[model samples]
Target: MAADGPGKKKHGVLFDVDGTLIDSSYFHAMAWWQAFRREGLDIEMSAIHRRVGMGGDKLIQSLVPDCTEDMQEELKAGHSAVFSTFWPSLRTFDSVRDLLAACSDAGLAVGLASSAQERDLEVSRHLLDAASSIDAWTSSNDAKESKPAPDILEACLEKLGLGPEDVVFVGDAVWDVKAGAAIGVPVIALTCGGISEAELRDAGAAEVYDNPRHLLEHLESSMIGKLMTGSLDA
Candidate 1:
């Protein structure tokens, strides 16, 4: 979901939904866990968490490199099956609403660029009650590839009618950073999704924050960093 409001419009901001803006990261891990179990594979939660931002196809392959392509599909299907059953339990992070509000209040267009399915993205919008603050959003369903590829971010930019120079992307995973870099958007790495600050930086994140609250606290400085620090925003 993207929120729209009347305000200044010099720039736009894109957000990653699962770990960056909401608390669904851990649930996604569990969903993947249940999905793998259904396929008779036992994997560690830590391993699953590390691959949380990857698309379903890559995710299954990352966990079980030896699995055949057909098995990968079955595993992905199983994971989705298990995850859908647990959707009712999902919740938004506490800082999400404030973060979006702050961005909009600061005269930035806010958008959601998540790798989650369209249905899951809708669930996030419903859970966060964030229909108004996000100006645009793009889901995995809208792209040919997911994170680590520029497709999702590209889709969001096209939908929002903004150039890469006019947007700043925020996310919680290394894949997010890679995707942002691939598209030439400056990325702010948020630690709320369980990725380390160093990892985010190495992945090409321009700045790293502990969570949305911290990012909001440093918005002017951080957002400015994105706008001018030798990237698309420049």
Candidate 2:
């Protein structure tokens, strides 16, 4: 909530919430499915799952592009309404708070670079309970486009007041890799979001992990860890 004033950290770490730090990917997909179902649209759950990390509008556009503009808005709102019902079911991944603390202690600005709604983000932050470790965060208000557009990542950069070279993004989706790549920020991909390691690498991820706990366990060897410690090689 406070600005990174004088003598603040130089390097930063941007993290995605859903499926990366939290275990809500499948729930999100189910919410989208229910929303589409209400419109008499029978979208496959697997299809919705593939677009879970991105915002609702982008997800609806990607999966149901044939719908009218008004229909798109309706579906998006429906998805939000449905997703809200499952907020109480949200849980943080193991060692999520530790990972944020590790970066913060290493003198890196910790940021949440998610396109989630503000209220949802607040819920996630409360779930993590690592406000002391966080330096900057983003909500849907900060970016219009979702993953693969680089807008969300760009907003995080602005929040941290750092350039792409000073940050390493951590996420669980290939769209995250693509967005980071678009802005020259290296990505550390996690496979717990239903994405394969090979697919993440193919999408330009510089490193990969199974989950937040795995990355935290191997912090010294991960790109984010190295970046935080000022040991990353040019």
Candidate 3:
């Protein structure tokens, strides 16, 4: 596709749902923990929390190197089943709806660059009820791999028909920053995902906000704001 097509989206914003937009990061960690336990891996919660943004396949390999292919599948299935029970606990952060609407009003395309599966995204979207502001979104199936790799972000870019330079990624994990860096996208990190501001900065985040509300409040001064206004030379 051409970069300057008649209907091409220019500036865009890609959001990571689990932490940046919702309060389910630890829930996911717990689900993964139970999944591993069911498979007799007995992984730690903190360890699983740190790897929450990674795809299930990569996460299983990272947490349990000795896991066989069949075991990996079983663990993932277990995690999915366990996670489904927490659907009622899923909640969006403050100003999540307003944040997406703000981006739309600012003349930028918004996309959900989540590494979650379709079922998970469906639950999130239903909870958020802000799909009208979203231009496009991607699930794990859209990418061959997930975070800390650029596959998922690349898939979002393709879906939105926007170039890497035309977007800013908003996420709440260090893995999100690494994934953005791998694809030449600046990540606006959030500490709401249980990661520290220092850790996010150390991971190469362009800026770190406390949560969706904080970012939304300072949108005009943010990298997102600068990009939307075309004031950022980068």
List the candidates' TM-scores in order: 0.89, 0.95, 0.95
CA displacement after TM-score superposition, residue 186 of candidate 3 (Å): 0.5
Can you write out model 1's per-residue Cα lDDT over 1-234, one digit (the tens) per residue?
A: 344532446578888888887777888899889878887888999999999998988887777989998888888777777778878887776677987887766566777887788788888888878767877887777889766888989887777778788888889999999988987888889998999998899888989999888887886678643453423336
Colliding pairs, model 1: 2-134, 3-132, 3-133, 3-134, 3-135, 35-79
- Select the stronger candidate by lDDT from 1 and 2: 2
The number of the candidate with the highest lDDT is 3
lDDT of each: 0.80, 0.87, 0.88
Measured by TM-score, how close is model 1 to the native structure?
0.89
Which runs of model 2 end up more than 4 angstroms from their true locations? 1-7
For residues 1-234, could you state the per-residue lDDT of candidate 2 as single tens digits? 334521467888899998999998998898889999999999999988988877677788888778799999888888889989999999999899999999888888888998888888888988989888988888888987877789988988887888899899999998899899999999999999998899999988999999998999999988876886678875
Q: For residue 73, what is the lDDT in candidate 2?
A: 83
Which residue runs does candidate 1 get wrong by more than 4 Å? 1-10, 224-233
Q: Which ten residues in a row have the lowest lDDT in candidate 2?
A: 1-10
Over 126-162, each residue of candidate 3 has an lDDT whose tens digit, in order, gives 8889867888888888888777898889988887888
